[model samples]
Target chain A: MKLRSQTRVILPYLGILAVYALLMAVGVPWLVRRGQLAAAETGAGFNPTSLVIYVVVISVVGLFAGLYVNLRADARQRHALNQLTQATRDLGEGRFKELEIPEDVGPLPETQALKGALESTAREIQYRMEAILKEQSMLSAVLSQMTDGLLIADDNGRVLLLNKMAEKLFMISQEKALGRSVVEVMRHHALVELWEKFRGGESKSITLEMGVNRNFLQVVGIRLDDEIPGRSMLLFQDLTQTHRLEIVRRDFISNISHELRTPMASLKALSETLLDGALEDPPAARRFVVRMDTEVDNLSQLVNELLELSRIESGRTNFDFQRVFPCGLMAKACERMTLQAERMGLSVGQECPDNLPQIFADPARISQVFINLIHNAIKFTPAGGKIQLSAWQDGGFVVFRVADTGVGIAQKDVSRIFERFYKADRARAGGGTGLGLSICKHMVEAHGGKIWAESEEGNGANFFFTIPVAST
Target chain B: MARLTLDRELRLVQDEILILGSLVEQAILNAVDALRRRDIAAAMEVQHNDRRINNKRFAIENRILILLATQSPMAHDLRLLAGMLEVITELERIGDYAKGIAKVCVRLAEEDTLIPIREITTMADKAISMLHRALDAFIAEDEAAARQIPLEDDEVDELYNLVYHKLIQTMINDPQAIDHANQILWVIHNLERTADRVTNICERIVFIHTGELMEMDSEDDESEDEDENLDTA
Candidate 1:
């Protein structure tokens, strides 16, 4: 190819030189003889020296012109080749800008055609490269933003891809986990078994619950036999919150059933006893009837308390918030419980400062909270023990306390006392429906306050609650 | 070519060890959970699953023996295979401990005494977590991590002590509860032993890295106390 191009450049110059040689060999000699003949005819001396010199000078000028033209043609070709080399270098370096081919390649058509082809090839590659990059970035963005964890592994169980959620779920870094075995990363036996099942064609997809205690994960594995042979994907969905809610719901159902059964059993036994023959004796019949009446009243109270608890829990119970003196609410609650406290040999006392800040709360609900606490205090306290009601302003709320000398709550059951139907060990024997503290919790929370208990078993119990101070 | 085959076979053995580790971990968790819920059926299931864990351990052991015979691994590889053998044994024993807890759960179901389930579950959590990290250190050949993991065993021991005293107090207060208290004590003893086994696994990890067989947590007196308690129970 190099020889052909070089020969093309020199061919025209060679043809010009050949024509000159032919003229010098044949035409020039003939012309010289004619000149000599003319000179002989004219009887003058025939001197051919000046004619030869003239022919040599013209041939030298023509040769210099051909050399100059060939040199200029070579320079243009070199310039075109340099441009093509630079474009190829830029393409290799990923700079896919337009190729700047000169308008002319010094009359070499093949060079011009090569330059055109290079330009079009760069454009095609640039277009395809941009499309691929766009798809890649989109895929990465989707993978990173996914809520569920995603992990893709090869047939050999080596991790090929993992998303941000997958990294978080396994507590592993992507760079470290990739190319590592899935079993090593997950560290769970069930997942390894799931992978084996997928490998053996036992199943296409499987879901299982993994993790211990409060943090539960539902893992879904799928074998990708068709899309990419011998690859698999895992999706991890965290089920901890759902599992906790299910537990709470189950506990509530069991507790509610246990609470209802005791009174129902008594009611059934009393009616059966009366039907068996207590009616023949009027006094005994009357006694059994009174017992049944008390049992019915207990059932009614339990039903009513359950309804009130549900209403408060669901935010269906409205609070008529009023600015009332804290002292007045304490006094009212003490007054309501004083008779019962005295009957049980416990003294009910109120210690609220008259100048304390008024609280924003439903007056009746706040009184009910106080009455419930005082009633609980009276029920648990021995004779001659004291039940004290105190209120003070703290921060933006009024803190109320009902302290009693009684068998206090156990350490473990302290946190759970506010759960409906949860009773302290002592409270179980000293009978009242176990919904009192749970109702108190909801009531105080509805007033935008907090409630808690501080106690030591066999010493005393102090129940505290807060209500927001009415803004002036 | 022989070197490549040995590397591949070693990886296969390591994978089997991990599978065995997970099975034992699951068993421990299920046993403690069954005790908490007083679910006799679940406890029986955990008991039944012990055979599977035993089979897995034997399978891994056979593979390691074959590797030792055929590959004749020297230096670090030999140490690794040997450490793996010890780890699987520890894992199998832990599985038996889980089965022991499950048996206690079954026995406790027949009695009316309330077991201190919260403390036992916490003990199980600590021990299983220690085992998990120990296995991770083994896989990564991390000597430093293996050294650090045994320190968590102290926490399990503390919980075990707390549960033991509480059960003793219960027995002293109510003589009728002595039988149930003994059963509960056995469960915690199993958990304490499981934690001890986790330390053993950690020791194996250190052995794999440094090629030295050394005890990590040498609380010989405490382990003796545990053994005495187990025998009395």
Candidate 2:
């Protein structure tokens, strides 16, 4: 039924025709000559035996030729069939090898058409495979380089894909995280809760803390369209630093209000007393006026300190870094605090090692630090208590300590004593504002130094600060 | 066609197990970080996410069951499925230990332990790295690498002992720190148990590769014996 088999029957007939023609040419001539001789001799037309021999020779030749031709055609068909089968299978698997039709086989149109279809199909598939590979690589490139953390999850909360940023933010590896549930990979309950809360189509945004860094991630989850079939995408933006700054800003405002209220209340009370006929008594009027002036001065000092703190914190404080004598700064600080010490009946002394190294600092700010520490020492120390200032070189910096024989800070309060507006003593017994130590900390830090306190309650307090020695 | 689907499903299960392993790894690191920072939020998060790890274990187990029932895999393929079935339990148990550490961190939320957590952190670092390498060996199917992974557990156990002794001394010196130090001791125990689970995973990797379930690392058993001796004394 095949083209090759049909040709097999026809080729044998062609071979038979060739053999018959040869026999006819030779036998007709020979028989004619023989007949002429017989007519001359005994009138015989042709030799029957010669005719039979010619017929037999022709039949044998035709049979062998037909068999050989048919066998060769069958071999060629088999070779072409193998080639076509292999090529088709390879093409289906996205391989594009050329079809190797056998060389001996003639132009078989059906097989040619099959080969053409395969080549074209292979070419089309190859092009599609390349395009898909390129698109996949491009997608992964985008995912890897994205800055914000991104995760795509299925309806069952299983993670389908995550970027490198998401991996880092969640402290998970992408190789291991994909196909796992997002809750397990992220390991943050707030995030899992956030996902659940937003999956219901109500809120799309929620903030949650995740990972070891407690990274505050602002997550927004959106349900993908039905085309993606129950998949959702989440975008995570880190907001830890922003949230901390916001809290700091809020506390700054509240602390400022509390600081201003005390002086305002005192001024109001003093003014009311003066206006309510306390002016008729001359001594009482003078006392009230002095009190009002002091309260006004306290308000002005609070405003100035607040401005200075903000300036230093904002990195806007100008620094004239210069080499200064440690002994001279100590003398200046002690001289400034002498009146306050005497008023409080406390003895103030300085003990600087004469060979102490010079420090690189903003001289005015450094002097302010010393003056503030001494003021605090004098205020907290009882009458006859001693306050000593000392300085010595420790490593790359010159360390200064203001040791006060005052009612010491509690063990717990020592850590927070240097914080802004934090008062160690709850009673309003000290005249100085609580901003002194905090101001000292900011100034010391600006000079590339450090500050801390050491104390045991009811024993003594020592506040230490260090300034880096000037580079030689 | 059935074989192709089986191969794909087997790969998916392998990936899921690695994901489960890394989840527990992250939980351990986060719990330790939270303890060091005194961060209650991170501690609580680790505790809350433990259930998700258990869920993933069940999912992986179900997939393994499905693969076995449908595909009827043999030899190494069978070993891989069975190994995965056992390994997920190890990963889940490790995750629970991490959650326990997180719970201890929450209990010590207010009180600061005088005992230094450095030794425990060192042990955690070793355990995490070991777990990481074990996962790598499992993925690569490297029997040699898997055999070499549990040798690092000796260092983790040593660090655990150091943390234990240091915590005991801290409690002895300051009786007030006894409650806090006891919580820290539990944390160290959790980290030690996590390292033990990593070794178990390594053994599973060897089993998946060779189909012979011989113990790959006997050092952990010896260390446990020694630890028991110390406890009794």
Candidate 3:
């Protein structure tokens, strides 16, 4: 340790001064008496007492001068030692930012070496800290940008680290979630249960549903690569939309089977009747053949509608855009459905306005939508029932309607009527293809329009659609 | 000297209790999820996993017993060891309730569901939330958080009452639905008991914090059967 005070620095020099003064007081007088004795023997004219006084005076002055020089030199060494001590203390506390030794105090060789060592030590510490920071930021950047949620849990199931995607997947903030148990933050039993099963290595992947939004997450728990005791990683991938699509695909298969089987059964029965001696009777054979042909036509139409609907839904079907008069389209649809309405003993009429704004749409597809609606109306309406086809401009689009005084749809089935192969109770009596309304909905939606039905059970039904008006 | 060793033992006991609590919570959640999905395999897995929860509780109990035997813990340390023993007991019972619910799931696997499954789910959710918060209070040694946990149990009770009446109404309307409704009622009862166990855990937390063993949960006045069961539990 450095001697800090000036008195401490000068105390040893003062002690040397005292010892020298005592020696001069005793030994110098003894030597002076001997010298005087020698001078008398030599008979020279010398003053012995004066010589003794002169020697004492010179020794006192020289001792005082040496003491002053010794004190200043010791103080400089103390100052140099103090600066080294301060720098060492700062380095001990890890305050590498300010490890400078004052230039004037540490001018000595030993202090200079000490300062050089401190500077290098501080530089090494700083380099290590910078390297650590860089690695941390790089790892965190990669984790945050990843689409999969990554969660690292300690042995006791506490959340040690979580990435941005993990925050969104678990619907918890990373700040509030750290050090909390997984069950506390996730709040999903499936994930907690998975962690338990995961402990035994029984299951790796588990599906968890989180929050009121019902987000489905497929969490895969993987053991950390270096066998870190009590630490594991969980990767979460959202699978809600995929699961929904799977359900839709399954439902469509069952619906298509039910739809195709009825027509197929009818065709089989008619063909069997003709083969079972109905061929011998001309009128019976002719009637059976015609019914079989109709069934075949219906089956083919169902297939055609299914293909068309799929094409439109998959965005493969393209539209030929044109400004078509709504009155002409309505008139043409009514004309096409006139025969079917007459056959069903229903009155079909057009109620289009003369100056209705033209619509930008695919004419062929629009005609297909209108034809399906009118055919459905003719199929369900009783004899003497009236079907009205109307068109008008509303808002940014021209709205079209096909209203029927028919056995209207039940309120419960109205929402699902536009789904593929969804046949209402009264519509099932008509035995037409079930994909008609679904195709119409897909076609209308493809044309940037919407279609919906307004009806009451045992009352009339009105199906309305809108197409964007042509910008003139 | 030996004081540091005793402190380390106390920490080990605390960690064991937390681990056991999490295991029991996981069991309950898995049991309820199995019930919702009607997955008999998942329900069976929950039942099988109850053994692990039991083993963990017993392991913690053994550690605490050894700690108490070898060392003389005074004041706060003594209270902590005693409180851990009591808290683990409550946790074990909660695990039993989860096992019971898993058993109900197995029985109701093939039956047509007549009652609203959403109500039962709501009851499970409330109970699980209470259990989670109670464990958090215990770990933090927060007396106020522990006191607030029992207040949340009232919501669980209300849900239980709602589930009870709805199940009873179903049994009254359709004679054929009686068997299924009875099984569902048992499931909801197990969830309610789990919520009750959570309150007991909170009470232990209060004891750990204040060194005062006071009943912090409110009485269920509406159900005489529930009150009787609570006393026995």
Which candidate should be chosen as best, given TM-score against the real structure? 1
What residue runs in model 3 are displaced by over 4 Å at the alpha carbon?
A1-101, A181-216, A225-230, A265-291, A334-356, A373-394, A400-434, A451-464, B1-233
DockQ of each: 0.62, 0.09, 0.10
lDDT of the structure predicted as candidate 2: 0.79
Enumerate the chain B TM-scores of all models.
0.95, 0.91, 0.92
* Inter-residue clash pairs, candidate 3: none
CAPRI rating of model 2: incorrect
Q: Per-model i-RMS in Å? A: 1.5, 6.5, 6.1
Judging by DockQ, tell me the better candidate of 2 and 3: 3
Query: Model 2 over residues B90-209: C-alpha lDDT tens digits?
Result: 888888888888888888877744435566677788888788778777777889988888888888888888878977887898898888888888788878877787888888988888
Alpha-carbon RMSD to native, per candidate: 4.7, 10.0, 8.4
TM-score: which is higher, 2 or 3?
3
Residue pairs with backbone atoms closer than 3 Å in model 2 (clashes): none
Ranking by DockQ: 1, 3, 2
Ranking by lDDT: 1, 3, 2
Worst 10 residues of 3 chain A by lDDT: A1-10
